[model samples]
Target: MLLRMPTSLSEAQRYLAEGAVPVGGATLVWALWQRDGFPEQAMSLRELPEATLIEREALGAAVLLHQVDDRVPDVLRRAASTVGTGAVRRTATVGGNIVGSTLRCLLPAALVLDARATVLDREGPYETDLAEVVAKRHLLLGLRWRDPVTSGYYKAPGEAGGPPPLVVATAVHTGSDGRHRLFVAVRDGYDVISETVPCHTGPDRALEALDDTGLGSLPAEAREAVRREVTGILGGPADR
Candidate 1:
C-alpha cells in the first residue's frame, strides 16, 4: 500500500477523495490491515495543522490520548487515562479512538458531553454531532464541546490487556435557562444507551432509563455490572 502524508487539510481531502483511507494513529488501521486488507492508498494526517491542537474546548483529531489532561473535562480525561497502557495511550489518537471499529471508552464520554466533530470531506469542513461522525467513520478535523459543570466516566473491568464490555459516562451541563441538564451514556459492545434528563433526577430514575435500551441483550454479568456502575455513578447504593 502507498502512504501519503498530507501537510494541509485540502491536500488531505483531495487524497481522501481520490480513495486514500485516512490514518491517524494507525493503531486500528494496522490491525485491520493485518486481518482484512484495507484501502491500497492511505493518507497520514499527522502533518496537518488540525492533527495537533488541544485547547480548553477543542481537540484535534490526531491529538494523542496521553495529551488529554486535567485541563479537559473530567469524563474525557478519565476515559483517556484508562484506555490502554502508557505506551499504547501515548500512540493512540483521539480520532482513531472515535472512528475505530473497537468499542473504545472515549465514545461514551463524547456522547455525554454532546461533542461536535469538524469533518473534512470532498466538499470542505462541516460541524456535526460526534455520534454521527463515529457512525459513518468520517474524516475528522477536530472536536468541540461546551465544557460541562461536572462529569465522570467508569469502565468495567474485563481482562488484562482486553477491552471492557461495558462503560458508563455522565455529564452535567447548564442550559440556557440556568437549569442543569444531566446526560448519561452507557456502552456495551457496539450497543449504546444515551439519555438526557434534569440534573436532579434520582438514581432510581436514572437506572430506569436503561429499561428501553435493550440492556437485557447483554451477558448476565455485563448487565449486572452496568447496573452497578450506573447506580454508583449516580450516587445510589450498590446492589448487594
Candidate 2:
C-alpha cells in the first residue's frame, strides 16, 4: 500500500479525491487493515502542522487524545481521559475518536459545546456541525467551539471496560444578552436518543426536564442513577 503524507489541506484533498483514505494516528485504520488488508492508498495528515494544533477554542483533527487532557475545558479533558490507557490515548486522534468509533466519549462533550467541524470535500473546505459531518462521512479538518460558562460529562461504561452504556453531557452558556443557555445530550451505544431540553430555572429544573424525554423509559434504578450522576456533576437535586 502507498502511504502519502500531505503537508497541506489542499494536497490532502487532492489525494482524497483520488480515493486515498485519510489516516490520523492510524489506530482505527490499522485495526481494519489487520483484518481486511491495506487500502490502495493512505493519506497521512500527520505531516500537516495545523492538523495537530490545540488552540484556545479549536482543536485540530489530528490532535492526540492525551494532548487534550489539561489544555481543554474540564468536561472535554475528563472525557478524553476515559479513552483507553496511556498508550491508546497517546496515539488516538480527536477526529478518529469522533468519526471512527461507533460510540465515543468525546462526542457527548462536543455536542454540549455545540462544536462545529471544518471538513474538506471535493468542493473545498466547508463547515458543519460535528454530528452532521459524522453522518455525512466527511473528512474532518478540525473542530471549533465557543467557551461555555460551565460544562460536564458523565459516562457509565459497560462491563470489562467495553463501550459505555450511558453517556450524558451538559453545558451552560450565557448569551450576549445574559440569558443562560443549557444543553444536554444523552447517548446510549449507537443511539443519540435524547434531545437538548431548556432549563430556564436552574440545575433542578434541568433534572426535571429529563423526565420529558425518553429517559423516563429507562428502568427506575437506571434512571435514578443517571439523575444522581448528572446531579453530582451539575449540582442539582440528586434525589429527584
Candidate 3:
C-alpha cells in the first residue's frame, strides 16, 4: 500500500514513469520486461490515494476495474475469459486496459452506470468523469461507481488464446435515492453517453424495467440493453 498522490499525469508520469516504460499493475511491469528488460522500480499501488469523484472524472481504467469486479455471473466468467486464458486475465489490470486504449469487457458496464471515478488529490477529494480521465495518460488507482445502477457487459473474443475483439456494455438502473443512470460503451476507443429517466427501484425493479425494455425482446441478441448471460434468464451473452 504505497500511497502516492500525484496532482496530475505529469506528476504520475515523473514519479512512476521510467524512461519510456509503462507502469501500472505487475502485468505491465512484466510485460515491459518481457519485451525489454527489468523495471527500475516495482511500483506498488495498493496504498495509493483514494479516488476522489470530482467532476465525474474518476473513471480510472478498464484494467483496474477488470481486476476488482468480483461479481459472480456468467458475464463475469465470460469477461474473465475475454482476453487470453485464466493466466492472462489474472495478470491484466483494468487500469492498464483502459490506459492502453484497448477494448476491454468492463467498458460496457462502466458506460451504462454513467459511472464516475472519485479522486483524492492534494487539494482534497474530487470526482472525474471516466471519459475525461482516460482521455490522456492519467494515473488512476481506484474508482467509486454510483450504487444500485443496472448495467451489463458483452464481449466478442478473438482467436482461442487472445483477447476479445470488442466488448459492449450498458448500465440502466434506478437508485434508491430516486435517480436514473443510463450508460453505454462501444468498441475499444469510443463510448456513448446518454441519460434515461429513472426506471428502477433496485434489483427487484428488474421485472418492471425488463417489461419496459421489452421482456419479450430479451434473450434476443446482444444488441444494446439488458442481457443476463450470467445465469440471469433474460438477455445475456453465452455463459462461458
Stretches > 4 Å off in candidate 1: 34-40, 161-163, 201-240
lDDT of 2 by residue, 139-180 (tens): 788888877767777777567556566777777666666776
Residue-pair clashes per candidate: 0, 0, 41
lDDT of 3 by residue, 50-125 (tens): 4221223233332333354334322333344565556757656656655554454554555455556543333434
The candidate that wins on TM-score is 2
Off by over 4 Å in 3: 1-22, 29-39, 47-81, 119-126, 160-164, 175-181, 188-240
Ranking by TM-score: 2, 1, 3
| Per-model C-alpha RMSD | 4.3, 3.6, 8.0
Between candidates 1 and 2, name the one with more favorable lDDT. Answer: 1
Error of 1 at 4 (Å): 2.4
Put down candidate 1 lDDT per residue, 129-182, tens digits, no spaces: 876887788888888888887777777777875655578787777898897666
Considering summed lDDT, which 10 consecutive residues are worst modelled in model 3? Answer: 51-60
TM per candidate: 0.82, 0.87, 0.55
TM-score of 3: 0.55
- Displacement of residue 104 (Cα, Å) in model 2 is 1.9
